[model samples]
Target: MKIGVLALQGAVAEHIRMLGLAGAEGVVIKRTEQLEELDGLIIPGGESTTIGKLMRTYGFIEAIREFSARRKPVFGTCAGMILVAKELSGQEEAHLGLMDIRVARNAFGRQRESFETDLAVKGMENTVRAVFIRAPLIESVGGNVDVLSVYQDQIVAARQEHLLAASFHPELTDDYGFHSYFLDMVRQYR
Candidate 1:
């Protein structure tokens, strides 16, 4: 499967490496047309507002929104998670509002406050090491969304239909299980 990593900012190369290590062709998505060739897509962690703005500048926001509406699989991590939330309590006007979840940006504090933890994700056979950096905490989730993982009593990862949002960066870890699992979702949909 061909997986595209949003290259506007963040850990794009890391995700590409992870996808390549998973035995899939990975592409760094820059132009809007790149979205068409993707079987799946991963939105990497970075400044949410900047990435969102760049997506708009490059016209990728509309493309991604349209693709996602068609049931395409999209996984977002960290600030990417913030971009995909349906609502952000304090910054409603800034969020992309893709997934049906309410998020609180910088809920875990600043970069100096970043941390790592083991997440007990449902269906993940082993404990996944999650890297949280300026993470957004899931405040609430709509009924259709499944709570996948949690950290310190806050919802860190969730899935609402084809959209998967995680407040932590799984690509930073050595494990590729999460990436593989996401690809499996793409395979199921494709």
Candidate 2:
């Protein structure tokens, strides 16, 4: 199946590479019109505010909401998680607000504090390597949200129906477990 990575910003190439490893065609989505051609979409990590601003400027906010309403799978990493959240701690505005979650932006501290870890994600047979860079933390989740993986007792990965979110960058690592899992999600939805 074809999976589209939101190309407004962030690690587009890395995610595309991961998607390739996961056995799916990865397409870069620069315009809202491109959303219609994908089976699933991945929103990669970047500066949350800047991504949100760009989404608004490009008229993607409502388009993405519509996309999610169709029950297609959506995966968000780091800043992308913040964008998908229904509420952002300390911030009055929400971006896409498609996932029923609340997040705290850069809760892992600055870039210098970034680190890597192996996480035993739910539904995975092996631990997955994750890279956290200025990551956000899931403060809370709605009843529909399923906790996937946690680190240091903090919510770092979760899934809500067609929506999947992670506080770390799975694409940055060599592991294809997360991408494979996302591909499964897409397959189920397709």
Candidate 3:
């Protein structure tokens, strides 16, 4: 399986490494044209506003929407989760607006307040280590969305069909379980 990590910004190499450990060929994707040959794409953690701007400027906004429209798997981590949500708490618009979720930007507070924890993800038997850095919170999810994992009674991970979202940076940990879970999604839809 060929999984591409959005290389506009943020832990691009880390995500690629995770994907490799998950048994998939990882590709660094900068151009929107790279979406074609990928079985799935991971939008890594970064500043949400900047990622939104870059996606628009690079023509990925529509390209990605189209890609998801075809049932292609998309995984969004941290700020990437904000980009994929349908609604932003105080904002009037969304970046990708692909997932049926409402998100709170920087809900975990500032960078200084960043923390790590083990979460009971829905499918996995073992707890997954999650690192939260100025992460977004999935305040609510529509009927189509499934709450995958929660931390302190708050939603931190979710999935809506082929779209997987995480409020924490899964790439920051040594565990490849989350990435493998995403690869399973890709395999199902591939």
Candidate 4:
């Protein structure tokens, strides 16, 4: 299976490497036209506002909405989770708004507060290592959204149909469980 990583900004190479471990071909998607050729997409962790602005500048916002409307899987990590949320705490606008969730940006404090931990993600046999770097917190979820995992009582991982979101960077760790789970989502959609 081929998966495209939104290469607008963030840890593009790290995500690609994780996808490789998950047994999928990971392609960097720099243009909206590239969205048509993927089974799934990964929006990696980065600066949320900057990523949103760049996506808008490059005309990727609508293109991605159309892509997700096709029922293909879309996985968002950290800043990506913020982008996929329908609403962001203390903010008026949302980026993609593909998932039915509300997020709080930088909820885990600043960059120096970033840390790592293991999480028990649903449908996985083992705990997945998670890296939080200025990650956003999923403050609330819609009825359709399934809570996957939580860290310190905070909603961190969730899935809404074909969309999967995580407040931590799974790609930063060596474990490929999250990526594999996402591939399974793509397979089911296909």
Every candidate's lDDT: 0.88, 0.95, 0.95, 0.95
Q: Give the TM-score of candidate 2.
A: 0.99
- How far is 123's C-alpha from truth in model 3 (Å)? 0.7
Model 3 off-target regions past 4 Å? Answer: none
* Clashing residue pairs found in predicted model 4: none
Model 1 alpha-carbon drift over 4 Å, by segment? none
Error of 4 at 87 (Å): 0.4
After superposing candidate 2, which stretches have Cα over 4 Å from the reference? none
Q: What's the lDDT of the predicted structure labeled candidate 1?
A: 0.88
- Give the per-residue lDDT digits (tens) of candidate 4, residues 1-190: 9999999899999999999998999999999999999999999999988999999999999999999999989999999999999999998989998999999999999999999999998899999999999889999999999999999999999999999999999999999999999999999999
- Model 3 alpha-carbon miss at residue 134, Å: 0.5
Where's the lowest-lDDT run of ten residues in candidate 4?
89-98
Work out the TM-score per prediction.
0.97, 0.99, 0.99, 0.99
Candidate 4 off by > 4 Å = none
